[model samples]
Every structure is written in C-alpha cells, then in structure tokens.
Target: MPMSEEAKALRRVYQREYRRTHPEQLKRQRECTRQWQRQHPEKCREYQRRYWERKAAQENK
Candidate 1:
C-alpha cells in the first residue's frame, strides 16, 4: 500500500531529526557508500543507468 501524505511528512520530519542528531553516523554511512562504489565501479554505473532511465520515464509521464 502507498503511504499517506501525513505519514510521508512524518517520516521526512523524523529523518531530518535523526540526521541532525546523528551527524557522525550519517558521515560514516556516506563514507561506506563511497567505499562500496569505488570498489564496484561497474555495478555503480549500471545502477546509475537504471536510475536515470526510471527518472526519465517518470518525467515523461
């Protein structure tokens, strides 16, 4: 089921609060993602390709 607008808003608020309170953790997570992408460049390119494709399709709609 799709999330209601109120639920989505609440989620955004919670996420913003969490990030504000956990800067170190978020920084570590981003570093880990960067490391993974560096170790898997091909996989990352494939993922980006699919992501852009989906984004383009959404915009066309």
Candidate 2:
C-alpha cells in the first residue's frame, strides 16, 4: 500500500530526529554498508543503478 502524505512527512520527521540523536549508530551502520559494498561490488552497482533509475523517473514526473 502507498503511504499517505501525512504518514510520509511523519516518517521523515522521525528519521531526521533519529539520525540527529544517534550519530554513533549511524556511523557504524554506514561503515557496515561500506564494508558490504566492498565485499559485493556487483550487487552494490545493481542497487545503485536501480536507485538512479527510480530517482530519474520521479524527477521526470
């Protein structure tokens, strides 16, 4: 199901607050992501390709 605008806004606010209050956790998570990307370059590239495609599609709308 698609999220309503209000739900999306609330999620954005919550995520922003979480990031602001959890710098160390976020740093560790980023480090883990980087390590995983290094260990799976092809998977990372495929994920990035899909991300950019979705971003471009959104912008074109």
Candidate 3:
C-alpha cells in the first residue's frame, strides 16, 4: 500500500513526522483511515461507537 497525496499533505499539516519513519503498510492504513473519515460520516460514527464502548467498559471496571 502507498500513501496518497492527501495523506502526505495531512501528515505535513499535522506535523506527523513520525509517519515518515513508520513502515509504509501502517502509513497506508492510517492514510486509508484518514480518507475514510473524510469521506464517510458513518465510519466516524463507528469510531465514536467504539470509543463509547471502551469508555463504558473502563467505567464499569
């Protein structure tokens, strides 16, 4: 997998120099995630769901 221009630009915008040193496969995954979050609100909703689930679980603990 390769990083798209959008992801490269995002990395620069966010000052994520660490992504440069990371393996490209992980970078590609992050890039895909970023793109999906930009293009799909439902994906973000899923993220929110997982977030609340983790939070609820931690609170229960």
Predicted candidate 1 versus true structure: per-residue lDDT over 25-59, tens digit per residue: 99999999999999999999999999999999999
Clashing pairs in 1: none
Maximum-TM-score candidate = 1
Off by over 4 Å in 2: 50-61
Instruction: Assess candidate 1 and give its lDDT.
Output: 0.99
Q: Provide the overall lDDT of each model, using Cα atoms, as 2-decimal numbers.
A: 0.99, 0.97, 0.86
Model 3: how far residue 38 lies from native, Å: 0.5
If scored against the real structure, what TM-score would every candidate get?
Answer: 0.87, 0.74, 0.41
* Model 2 / residue 7 / CA error / Å: 0.5
Q: How close is candidate 2 to the true structure, as a TM-score?
A: 0.74
Preferred candidate (lDDT higher): 2 or 3: 2
Clash pairs, candidate 3, are none
Ranking by lDDT: 1, 2, 3
Error of 2 at 34 (Å): 0.2
True lDDT of residue 15, candidate 2: 100
